[model samples]
Target chain A: MADESGVLVLGDSTGGELSSMSRELLTAGRKAADDLGEELAIGLLGATLDQPSQQAISYGADKVYAVTHPQLAQYQVDLYLAAMEALCRDVSPRIVLIGRTNEGRELAPRLAFRLGVGLAQDCLEISVDAGSKTLLANRPVYGGNAIAVVRCNYTPQIAAIRPKVYEPLEPDSSRQGQVVSFPVELDPSQARSQVVNVVEEAAEGVKLEDARVVVSGGRGLGGPEPFKDLETLANLLGGAVGASRAAVDSGWVPSSYQVGLTGKTITPEVYITVAISGASQHMAGCSGAKVIVAINKDAESNIFKEARYGVVGDWEQVVPAFTEAVRELTQS
Target chain B: MPVSIAVLAKQVIDPEMPMAAFRIDADAKAVVPPSNIPPVVNGFDENAVEAALQIKDSQEASITVISTGTSFALDVMKKPLSMGADELVLLQDDAFENSIDSFFTAQLLAAAIRKLGGFDLIICGRQASDWDNAQVPLGVAEILGLSCISLGKKVEIKDGKVSVERITNDGYEVVEAPLPALVTVSNELGQPRYPTLRGIMAATRKQPTIWSSADLDADASQLEPRITLQELFVPVRDQQCEIIEGDDAADAGRQLALKLREAKLI
Candidate 1:
């Protein structure tokens, strides 16, 4: 399962399941291995992970290092990171990559500390330094104001990449790979931060991340009155409702419902911005949407520049008409 | 009681900087701003300052303000000293800002505090407005080997032990930890108070002591930047504006419908 460059990716599992960001890491890992002419191996650390290992294989992992143990079933920071660290020590990988999720953010740093090397987090981009084989990691700095390139001089150069930045490889069901199940040795008592409870959000229909169509209202909605209109439109079009940071800051909307850098990053099929001015910080989260439509009174609003289609009219007049038209089309 | 408390403060680019001042220089491949980008004590840090002051008001603890920044920070950081931190430590060497990662910053602060000694609590904003890393407290805790509770929206100290109410998505988690712990305050904790003119006048005479990487006994290798920033620029957007034209309301509805159909959204 070792590549020519000996690069291997360790897939992170949260809540006893594979995270969405893991696929993106695999994509980047595969690309990096391809560039280095190495086979990209994946170390999937979990308790019992046959299905997720096969899924990883389909996503361009050459070999899956299936480290299993009853103690590793849940995310215990110390135990989980120790398992991955032990795997890397044995495998002797030249480069290691992980998803920049909560688990990755915590694990990579601790693992790097244990391994006595530097670890990079939240990298928007990564490339191998041709001369040095140093993994160059580009991460957002200054609150999305600037990007800094981070490099590791130590062996097994590690990186944690943000999700959605790298497109996942086409999954092939027939793809084949080896799964070597290794026994993990650790006790749960060693964990620092215990997960007392795992509570999932109540809303089930369409997660903000996975939603194809999103209708977002902002502070300009004035109050809860226009929210009904926005929700009506979202429901009519089978979309989720998003709100700008301004709306959240103004207390017009909950922070969970806000869409921006601090909020959830969405890559919906279509996004409608109602009264959003498209500030740079806010745009970072929503820029991934496929089709953007801006509806604002100001023709020169920043949202207009980012939207694919815009209406420079009052949303009060435009929303109802837009809702009716969507119903007419979807119903037909 | 000889209890000393260190409050972490940061100077950030004012959150309300005008958009008109933002300009992208193609040659520099960076965002060129008009000279009016003023620095201020980050709003969250101000909350931390007020929290520190509240403790100093009643508990009779020595309050110290610690910050990591460059020359631009000195002006804005004065607010905290005026608000009543008994002393100030500014880590402003060239190497400090060059690296300035959470781990390094925490290491430096912990070293400085260790030199001073006898600190009961360390106060800081839950997250900084500029970096928003939220790692300093955790990093400091790990470095100093102390207990830390973050996102403290409400804090109360009694009998030398601290009671902190942490705001989470569900509701709040109230935890009681012993003294010599690190606590970071958020906006949800309380609004920061405005300094009076008398307080401002007193602050004018106060000077924060500047410490370098050497002063903190931090190794050069430990403080080096892991991430290198190549460029900074605003992302390009590809939005096109199209007005749905019609003379009447019915015509407008029909036109909008036609536009949706044409785009295959129907």
Candidate 2:
């Protein structure tokens, strides 16, 4: 009976590995399931995702349903939507959770529409309402200036949870669960959009999402050349270099390195914001960082209000020296 | 054959309005439109219009602009018309006045598109600036059983096929689909061109065709929002700034590093 109506978590895999966002969703799903007195099930759809299915079990999924097909290697809207829709029909879950990833954003809405369910996109928090027994999805609106607690009036409530908002539980190697193979058929003609090629940006060191220490520069840096100093500091800290939307829009940095509402959301141990005014949109992405250090010449900069430690100084004069100090401190 | 393109535009409260001026009525769970800052075309939707206009510029094509809301300020909605849209269709009804979710919006928009007839392509912003929910384009395409390319930075139609450069996490991907599809344009496509004097004057002569829910034959039941707003509030921050003092800028940098190290953050 529990298998028939459990909390379903959509496991997103990239390059045959479970995405960080998927793991985060599982963590969130676990809590919601516990609160609702239901079991948690994970759905993995890909050409090859056996390893990630087992990993999901260790992360707290009681059952793992994987659908594999050759056409599932690359993300196609039709194939994925059909697979998930089929799964939902087979196992009528009370709630469905998907990561707010590139693919998830596209798939979640379509699934909800097909299921005739309600959907909450890019949610920051998810919990069960004690009295109503309905799911409450907290999402930011108006560029993160305010948050709205949204509830779906329909069954099988669906939500696309943002990455880094919930921490994944520690994996227990000894844990075991049922792995079910779900069959799915794909026709070549169904795929309207075909991915000709994927071009990855040339980036060295840690990826922005995985970086523990993020060194981000803003328009305050004045130009792209100053990013070199940020790179040096990021390298010394063994982290990644990021940028504000202003810097990216100014053509000082590529869009991939941007950190803001329209860009990637990052939750690092330490986020060093240089010359950023901390616009609400930008803060929406990095507010999850454990500690924020802001450096700007303007004392009234908005970034300072959110930063744990702030230095009112020019980047050119402060960054190089800061890099040198960090290098020395880490070398010893 | 000349191509027919329909661009979806939305009027949203300017996202760039300063935080201090932004206000929300918690009880109503609605944003109080700052009178000083009037509603403008969502920035990304402007990019979508620009994408459609560029295609219109290079080829023989007709561009139709569509928007759905309770009341669209003509002054704001006419910006797309002034920029060279062949026609503007406004979907307005009192039932849509409240907080309608994306599903209902997409369903109505899809129905309206069907009523318009003979559109080879549909374009929409990656997401609205106010709600920031990038779901409508895909939802509309799903309802119409059409292909959708999301976050397209570049789009072109030739020989009844659509080619698009889609923005990805790392970089971008080149994808292709048959005509009679939809694509959502991102800001990476570039800033939209401003209207010229001649174009503005021509817009003054053009009137938008307004369609209510009755004309579209929209199902009032389906038009109802599935999602309900439970509560709305501003997130409060308890942290205060602790400015690190230093003799100079460089010294301040050193002190900052030391403080971070002490916190074991580095």
Candidate 3:
């Protein structure tokens, strides 16, 4: 079903690992297509398409425009944006959705500007109005306290959706897709950025963004050493370790694990904050957590107000009890 | 040559308030306003101001601050101008309250910047706090047709091209592009500077250049929303917290272990 405004989903495959974000985009795109009564087309831009193209179909893309170029092997903004502009011009999509990963965060705005349209970034949810065919994009605003519904009056209403905000449907390996080869021409010398290396995270169990249970630590833990207990609990539960901006700025954890307005936004089943004094900045990252447990020495800490369960005790004593109790319960 | 840089900033509700203070209208897909919402410069845009200051710190440059909102919102956006800005542009309009979307927001700023002229660089936070769509920089870059870099954590200008270190989960990617490009700053870019007393005095006396939609030369049709937000709602939070029943310390461990296993973990 094609309408006045078509849908184009964009994905970037780095070193053969189709970004989890790309998969999430496909999921959202598939749903948007069904709701809008439009065909979903995907643009896979990279140096190669061997593994990613297949994954795109499994995730739910009907047609894939694969552009393989030597210069594209590296994620160059100019090259990629230029290619995307060309693709959008050819397809004339009413809505262009990209993942809020590093590339999408940068590219969508540029693409929207080039097309002279409106663009929404890092949206949590997007839907199309049946009669008007207008896209209603919902995203966190003012940290995480408020959400704004954005509508683009212009054509090619482009947007970047955050990863993990939406759940992906089970992949059907049998799903087939049409592969349209897009020939990309680029000058190697024209690109300013070169991919010197790719460093992957070595964490096991659940990825940070996709984690169900998140165990977070803050400055109240006193030092970085105490977080070992928190990490142990997270690992045992097959979850991820998150940190407050205080802990990250204190060098207790890498900035990657930081959760706050300036850090990663997560929505987990359970979030346990150890020795953390709740600040608006820190809480912004974890407000979406379903269950919050705060263990702190300060009885009047603001974290208690946000916590489902509050333990007004030392972290050293509480973390061990919580961990040991879980250990025994699981063992039984 | 040092580039002229302009930053568009906005005041947004603090998102990390307690549930008691916030409410979500799930059906409307919008968050209900809490009475105690504190104002702050949108997170990503602070990095933009810092990026502009960095360019000024390294070379001879003029950085201006532009904001679109109520006069009361001035305190939220003016801090950066005092920290180290050469000028300030304010587009205060009542319609701006509902027109926070990046498209029109960009149009408002682009009109002012275009009128100012002689700008070699533009910096914006990836997104505003209230909108958090991260679209303005790319939109402004596109409207101007200059190259654009988003999530730039580190930036340097040399030989008419700006080199930037963009932060990614994998690490940082270094890219260089020609001048007259737009760069959106990442949180890791650097800490924003506090305004000095002398700088504060200057900002107090400084008259921000004001422009209306008429002055901007923007199409009224383009200003009209393509998408309409019918309603706003806040999400409801429900948590089921259960305490483990046990006697001795070791026994408590057993109870906790049982719960973990019940959740399918060893």
Candidate 4:
């Protein structure tokens, strides 16, 4: 008999490779499944998901469901929704976990709505409630000022977990699991919105999320020119350049580089914030950094309160000298 | 025929509330509304209204603003009206109090839209500032079975088709969809315009059409929230500061670099 009680994880893939976030979800799902004394299942939806399905099992999924079709190559909201909804109705899992990526954020809500269930988005933590045998999702709210623990009263509890919050388990190559191929019929005419083109922004160096060291600037930089200096510092440290929402809104940098509640959450080893008065919103994203360094002309800036090290000085005078010193130190 | 559009708006706690004053009651599992800070229209929802207004400015169109909440302050509800929306439809009922997740919220809003009859387009914020779920627009689109374009930074309508610049993880994609579709506007659309004095005066004379759960024949039990708040708490940060001493600005920079190197950060 098909397992009626299991934790179902949605595996998202891009460019024919399983996303790291999907792996993290599997790790989290494994823990939740262990707690509930249930099985862990993963669902991969795309055109050709053979490799990803095997990878899901290796990461700890006991069973993998691969839903494939020609129209499923690129993510179409309606198409993915229909396939997942069908799979959920057939399997009837107790909990559904999805990554809070662009695709996951778009899919989780619609799936929950279709199933007449509740969804918690961008959750920081997920755990099983021992008493009710339900899932508890902890998420940041009020622009990251507070945390709320929420539980789904209905079955098939759904949640969208944030990337990097949970660590993925090391894949065991020898692990074996069942792979089920579920085929679904998709009508091309049903898709109203089609992706015309996906243009990747020409990014240099490491991505903000993966960077070990991050050098971020704020409105205090005055203009976009000073960001080049921050980039130089980031390059010298082998890190990536980030920005505050103000700087991005000021047209100094692209939204991709923004670090805050509305932007990307980064947990680098060292976070150097320059010319940025630390707003609670910006700090919410980078608070997990091991060390925070603030450089601003204002000694009383809010950033200093949150920083482990504070330097009261103009960024123009401090950043260049700091960049040169780092170059020399790294060279030695 | 002139284009008819419905822009979804929401009233939320002030996002700009200072951190020092922000508080949550763990016992109540609710955010304690800071007495000084009053609830306002969600910033992104206003951006959705702005997107609608821009379209109305270029062509002959009618814009109706809609919201679903238990008790919406009139001042907050009138914001879009004061910003040039032709009508406001509010779904307010005791049945919607304290519960109703985004799914049910969308279902109720969709029912109201259907009752409104003719609408060529529906626009909403990518997400609300409070829950930050970014789900309702997609949920509404799903319930209505309409083409949905999300994270739209730029939207335009011409000849029964909509063109949008949709924000993606990498960058953005230019997408086109047919009429009667829903688009979730992002902050990239730019700041919503402030209401003019004339617009505010005109709004004073307009009364919003209020509907209860019974009005839409919504199943009361189906409207119950799927997710329940278990607990609310403030996160504590434990860190101590170490000021990097220097002779001057450049010296401080040097000292900071040396300290980072000693810590094996660079």
Candidate 5:
């Protein structure tokens, strides 16, 4: 082997199954490994690992390093960071990919700082230069107003890929790979944050990313009352309601309603935006949708440019009619 | 014992600026601020400040705001003070121009934190609006060996530990950490309190304690950038939209719904 240098995917799990973000990271990891002609290894932290390890392999990992410990079951910066640092030191991989999940948002920077290397956060694309073997990435900046291409100067370069940017590889059950229980001596005393309880917002139980259709509103909605109209339409269409950053910032809606670069990233079958001017940041979160339908008053609004179908009209008059039509069409 | 809290805030170009006015200075490898609009405190940083103010509201605590940058808008940076922060500290220096690298920024901020010791907690925004790196708070925690928590919408201090209602993909989880921890807050904390006229007058009467790179213990070599910016530009899009037309706005709305039904989008 040229060296112990390869791509390592920092895998995560939810409810014992492989997390979607982890699967997507494997996609990016597999790409770099293929380009570099090196093994694609995944590092997963948990109390149990047999199933998640195999799942990672089925998603294209050639090897799985399960960093196992009793306290490692959940994510804590003090404990998880220690284990990841130990794992990185042992594997000595050339590239590390972390999903920009809640955990990754915290871990990637700390990991990069701990390793004394560099990180490109919230990257939408990553590639390795063939000649120099340098890792490069395209990341959105200025709230996704622009894109910046960055390069890492130090070894074991790290990146936290934005979720939904890369599609997950289809699982191949017959695909065989090796898994090793990479043990770490975790100190419970060193840990700081303790998870008391995980409570799901009941109203948001219908996840936006999982929805087939999403009807979203923005500043043009005027106030929170209009969101009820959007909710009516979404329910009629069997979808969810989303809000632009403006609406969320205006206190017209909770931030959970927001969908943008800083908010949530959703890839639905159909995205319907109402009275929303599509900012690049907002588009970044929903551009992957199969079809985008925009309803706005401004004909010159940017949402039209990214949408497949659009209506230029006041949302007040348009939304109610749209809801009625959706109800009639679905009822019949 | 009264708790000592440090809130880290940054002044950034108004993210609310019209997209058409957003520009990239390829020659400088930086974003060119729109001349007509003034920079404001980053949106998320205001949330962090709100988190601190909420804690202060319930307990006997002192809030000290800190910011490290090449320069800052005095009024903008003082918004935290007007919102109830007891004191302000500005780590303004040319050396921070290398803040493009989170490592440098972290080292400098950590050094300043160390110099202003006795802080039981450090709160920062989940990420800044400009670079959107979301790295400095975690980096500072790493450099200072502090316990770190991210994406907290609700934060409180009790039983000698800080507990945060952390935002997750599905919902939120209640997390507790011991003192000397770092917490990053997001917009879910709700809008920051508006500065009252009386508070504004008091803030106007107050002056911030300023520090430079030389005031900290960090060395020159420790601030070298690990990441390099190769290029900066706006992404291009070319999707041509089909405008649905009808007799009136209401008709167009119906037509749009019918269009979606035809495309099997629903």
Candidate 6:
């Protein structure tokens, strides 16, 4: 499949499956490709293909390319960049999409710099300019205080899309697509950095990103002890516990629990904020939530402005009562 | 020989400013600076300085702080020095004003680093607060052919290599890169150290070295901007929060839960 001049999603199959972010990229890619009247191709690079090639097709990829190399087993910036640069050059896709993920945050920039093109990072939306057929990206800046619409002046424009902003298409198992093996030579020695150990701090139930309900706390929670109450509420609702950057910076919670522009971007069905001031940066992470609930002593908090439901009260007085009520309701 | 470290910091509009003060001059396609508050060094960049200073705390390392912009508030730019960095270098020019192009910013910074060579490590913030490009450091590493490890919550130099506890979604990975590498730090690294009176006094005595495109043999005329801003505006929120009222705080809590349940949100 030498079909070029279309959209290419630099999909990630880190866990031997299509990542949710990768799937989100497809939904965004499909929209952009459809708008531009171009084909959408998805590329996966790793030592082992996650069988996500078929998964990519089901998600909306018209063509799938798996670029594999021994050195590509894990995300080593040098090898991934080399393989991806080679893949882009060979396919010459007009526009490329990468998830604004932890690895993608590094990979996208390096790849763009390598390709000698421009990349709009952490974009909330990617639109097609009909007349120019170029990619226009809207990204949050100044800690999500404002949104800037940006355009790539050169071909092979790149974008790192924030996860949770776009929903993935439901998979159709009956869909059929061919997986092309694009060969990219990579020498393991070319890798400049190596990961010697990985520590898993989040080894419990209800991953933050996958949670439907999220109860978050902030500096106003006073100390780490209050997190237990939030966790209790989250557990009752079968949700996850989150934190504001202030909480994380205060060492009351781990960085993994932080929700903000510089932290994790999550979209839950029911997002409850406890005592958070709702900085625009914090709002950037949870704005995609279907509904927001803010509980703060100060009614003027920016979070209430973005929330669907709110209460003006001290978290110490309100949270336990809310938790008890949620528990009672869930038990019934 | 003392290990040489280059720390890249940026001064940006305060990210902590109130939402109401965040106004975009639509006609200018720029954010209007709030008059009440002044700009500060990017928070993550402060983390980078702390990371470098931590290395200095344990080992013999000379830290040189570099910042590029159309202008500088010298006092804010000298923050790293006050925090115990050895030297300060400012890359300022008229062309750098309202610079949204991360690639060009990286190019100029890379040129400055090249002009002041012999550095074993380069440290920068994960991203700037204004543009949030998160590209300049990595772009510089790409141009300099240096190994780059990003989002380091804990950075240490050992065995003549940079070891970083790189933050991942669920946890962190211990990544190691050889010398002459680049690393970007985040807030997870911990609060940067407060500038001591002694350190601040020393910083007052030391003068910053200023450089422009002319000072460094970097080409700027031929380069095209990597990103062009089409529009800048505050995103509107259509949410109308129903503030659940009650006689007391606990009653309000109970009422809010019932409201959510009534709305089928719970």
Please tell me which predicted candidate would have the highest lDDT against the true structure. 6
By DockQ thresholds, what CAPRI class is model 4? Answer: medium
lDDT of 1 at B53: 81
Q: Which segments of model 3 are wrong by more than 4 Å?
A: A1-6, A14-18, A187-213, A232-240, A260-262, A265-271, A277-294, A297-312, A323-332, B1-3, B13-40, B70-77, B158-160, B243-266
* RMSD, every candidate, angstroms: 4.2, 1.9, 4.2, 2.1, 2.2, 1.8
lDDT tens digits by residue: candidate 1, A68-153: 88887765656787788789888888788877553554466556656655566667788876666668777665555555556665
Two-way lDDT contest, 2 vs 3, winner: 2
Instruction: Calculate each model's fnat, 2 decimals.
Output: 0.26, 0.81, 0.41, 0.78, 0.86, 0.87
Q: Please write out the lDDT profile of model 6 over residues A70-105, one tens digit for every residue.
A: 777777878888898999998899899998888898
Error of 1 at B101 (Å): 5.2
Candidate 3, B23: how far from true, in Å? 7.6
Clashes of each: 9, 0, 34, 0, 0, 0
lDDT of 3 at A11: 85
The better-scoring model by lDDT among 4 and 5 is: 5
Supply the DockQ value of model 5. 0.70
Write down the DockQ of candidate 3: 0.35
Number of residue pairs clashing in candidate 6, backbone atoms closer than 3 angstroms, sequence gap of 3 or more or interchain: 0
Strongest candidate by DockQ: 6
Total clashing pairs in model 3: 34
Model 4 misplacement above 4 A: A1-3, A298-302, B98-100
lDDT of 5 by residue, A79-189 (tens): 888999999989999999999876788889989999998899999999988678788999988877788899887878899999988989989999989998899997799
lDDT of 3 by residue, A190-277 (tens): 5544444444433556767778888899988878898788888888777889888778657676667777765677888888788898
Cα displacement (Å) at residue A332, model 4: 3.3
What local lDDT does model 6 show for residue A229? 83
Give the per-residue Cα lDDT of candidate 3 at A268.
89
Instruction: Report the interface RMSD that candidate 3 achieves against the true structure, in angstroms.
Output: 3.9
**DockQ of predictions, in order shown:** 0.34, 0.78, 0.35, 0.71, 0.70, 0.85
Candidate 6's C-alpha runs over 4 A off are A1-4
Clashing pairs in 1: A3-A39, A148-B228, A148-B229, A149-B227, A149-B228, A149-B229, A150-B227, A150-B228, A307-B239
